[model samples]
Target chain A: MKNLRLKAARASLDLSQQALADAVGVSRQTINAIEKGDYNPTIRLCVSICKVLGRSLDELFWEDD
Target chain B: MDWLVRISGVVALVCIGVMVYLIVKMSPDGFRKEQYDERQTLERLKAARAGFYAMLIVALIYLIVTSFAPELGNQSRVWMCVMLFFGIGTFCLYAIFSDAFFSLRQKPWLYLLLIGVNLLTQGFNLVNYFADGGTLRDSVGTNYILVLGMILLLLIIGAALVIKMILDRTERD
Candidate 1:
């Protein structure tokens, strides 16, 4: 359930999880949790993360087979 | 003995002062936003719920104990305080260790310093008690156990904060 696409997007921007978390005003653990699928963030947090990574919501949060 | 009670009283006051200060500091909008987010807030609410249940259980047990042991008549108030302390302390510890309180942005040093001061004051009382050949139970009967429990609670929270600080630092690095 981990968001590998989000990880890739962050890497492409050369941003660490801490950097992204700071940009979104959250703890790094929150970013890590989102990436690991350990926590389900609110839509607001999802939008914030998407905005920070310059990604669309579907690209970062939506699951595709 | 009177001196010991006075010292313990002062230590208790210092601890109360520190908790009040932290509560006040954590109340402001800026501090809350900076140090506490949705996740932390959710965790705190959970902790509070757990604490409430614990308080009920402890109170029940205390009533049972006192009812069964009539010889402990006059010390019921002291035991009640102990029960209340543990009930609240359990929740505080849970919140702290779960990253709900004293997180990366919170100023844990001030709390730690206040706890350290309380510990030192208690240590002084202990040394004086030993000099007079007083036993631990005697000290508690004199109400020193209240301060001791406070010190133990603070130490647990302090240790949790230290571990959280290290973990957060490692994560950032």
Candidate 2:
């Protein structure tokens, strides 16, 4: 459930949660929650995050079985 | 006694007005619409729901108390105000702990300073009242219970904010 792919993508770009949150216009806590599997972000927010991290939606959000 | 009540009311209103002005001044956009992120907004809505339920419970308790003790019916206005304060305190504490109290453009430290000032001002008035041989209820039956309730509410919120700040610092990402 945790979005480790998103976290890794953000880290690969040397982005802290706060940095990513600022880029995506959200609170750092929201970003933290998303990474920690505590919250399910909306598709709109997911797109924003993916765009900020320079990742495709499938690369970051897809949960492959 | 009436003059004392009038002066206290005026002073309290002025303090509140000053706090509001400071909040607006400290905001990034003066007098404009404030905004919050989606998660903050959702958390705030949940906090508001909790506050609504708290108010309902307080009202129910007040109604039951008044029904049993008809004498308290005379002070219904004071009780109503106290109930409102309790509800506000509940909402504020929830939002603060959830990190949803401050908007993106608002500074939490500034707001906390304002709350501290208001608390100290009320506390000073309370101490002065007690020092001047003033009881909770005067001859005209004007009770200072509402003031006490306000002070209690401020204290709780202030303490909660302090604790939340500590937690945020320790849990920083």
Q: What TM-scores do the predictions have? A: 0.71, 0.82
Model 1 stretches astray by more than 4 angstroms:
B1-34, B107-114, B129-143, B163-173
Best by lDDT: 2
lDDT of 2 by residue, B55-103 (tens): 9998998899989997887776677777788789889988987778888
Clashes per candidate (backbone, < 3 Å): 0, 0
Best prediction by TM-score: 2
Docking class of 1: acceptable
Give a tens-digit lDDT track for model 2, residues A1-65. Answer: 89889888988999988899889988888898889888888999999998888889999888899
Q: Which residue pairs in model 1 clash with each other?
A: none
Off by over 4 Å in 2: B1-28, B138-144
| C-alpha DockQ of every model | 0.40, 0.72
